[model samples]
Target: MDPSRVVLFKSLSKTLSPALGIGWIVAPPRWTQQLHRADQVDAQPSALDQLAFAELLESGAYDRHLRSCRQRYRLRRDTLVQALAKQLPDAPVSGVAAGLHLILRLPTAVDTRAVVTAAAARSLRVADLATYHATDDHADHGLVLGYGNLADSAVIEAVRHLRDAVEECG
Candidate 1:
C-alpha cells in the first residue's frame, strides 16, 4: 500500500470512529486471502451455505455494510416524514433520525388497538407504541410505524387510515 494512501485512510478512519462511537480501527482487505484470514476461515463457504457470518462481523465487515444501509434508510425516513407532514400535519410524529422506526403520537381518544384493528381490516399491519412503553395513565396513544418495509403509497394510505381511525374514534 502507498504510504500516502495509508495515512489518508487512517485519518478518515480516526474522524469517523468518534462519530460512529467505534473505538477500534480495522484495515480493509485488499485481497480475498486477507478477507478469508480476517474472518478466520480455513475453507471457502459456498453460495448456498450459511457459514460463520457472525464471526466475520467482528472484522467490521457487517458495520461497513450497515453504514451503507443506514444512509439509504435515512433518505427513506426523510421522505416518510415529509409525506406525513404534508398529509397529516396535526399528527404528532417523533424520531425523525436514523432508525428503522418512528413514533406517531395520536390523539388521546385514539385507541391504538382500534387503529391497528382498522388497519388490519384494510389489509395493513401496524404496531401500537403504548404496548412497548410503560404508561400507567395511558398518555398520548399512538402507533410506532416502521418505514423499513412500507412503500411510499402504503405509508401514505396508512397515515390516512390512521387519521380516519382517530376521527372515527372521536
Candidate 2:
C-alpha cells in the first residue's frame, strides 16, 4: 500500500475516557495541511483533556493503566467463561477470546426474545442475537452478553441466573 494513500486515525477516547474525545490523524503533509485548514472551522478537543493525556503519556502512567485494564478485563472474561461453561454447559459460547462481550448460542427451538425478557426479569441484561442482523430474522438465535462491567465475584451468580432464564425460556 502507498503511504500517501493511507491515513491513520487514533483516538484517546477508546483507551482513555470517551468524555475526553481527544484524537489525531497521521497523513502526508499535503493531506494534513488540508485537514488543518478544515480543522479551523471544526471544533477541537479540550485543551485540558489534551494536557491530561500528554501528562499520562509523559509519565508512563497511560501504559501502566492500559496494562492494568487488560489484566482486569482478562480476569473478568475468564471468570465469565468458566462460570458459563459450568452453568450453561449446553449453550455454546463464541467470540470469547477478545473484546468486552461474547455470544451465547441457544437452541433452535428457543425463543431469543423470550430469553431476553426472562433474563431481564431475573435482573440479568442480555441482547437477542437476531437484533444485530439486518435480515433473516430467524437464524443463529443467541444472547450477546457483556462482561465488561460485571463484578468478578458476581460472575457465577450471574451465570446461574442466566442458566435459570435459559432453561425457563428455552
Using TM-score as the measure, the top candidate is 2
TM-score of each: 0.56, 0.89
lDDT of 1 by residue, 55-121 (tens): 4466887678668767767777877777777766767688776367888777666677888888777
Q: Which residue ranges in model 1 land beyond 4 Å of their true spot?
A: 1-64
Clashing residue pairs, candidate 1? Answer: none
Candidate models: Cα lDDT each: 0.64, 0.87
Cα deviation of 119 in candidate 1 (Å)?
1.3
Angstrom error of the Cα, residue 130, model 2: value is: 0.5
TM-score of 1: 0.56
Give the Cα RMSD of candidate 1.
10.9
Model 2's number of clashes is 0
Across 1-170, the per-residue lDDT of candidate 2 in tens digits comes to 57788888888776777777788888877797688877763667778878988999999999999999999999889888888888888888999987899999988778889989999999999999999988985668799999887888888899998998888987
Q: Kindly report which residue pairs in candidate 2 clash with one another.
A: none
Give the per-residue Cα lDDT of candidate 2 at 108.
79
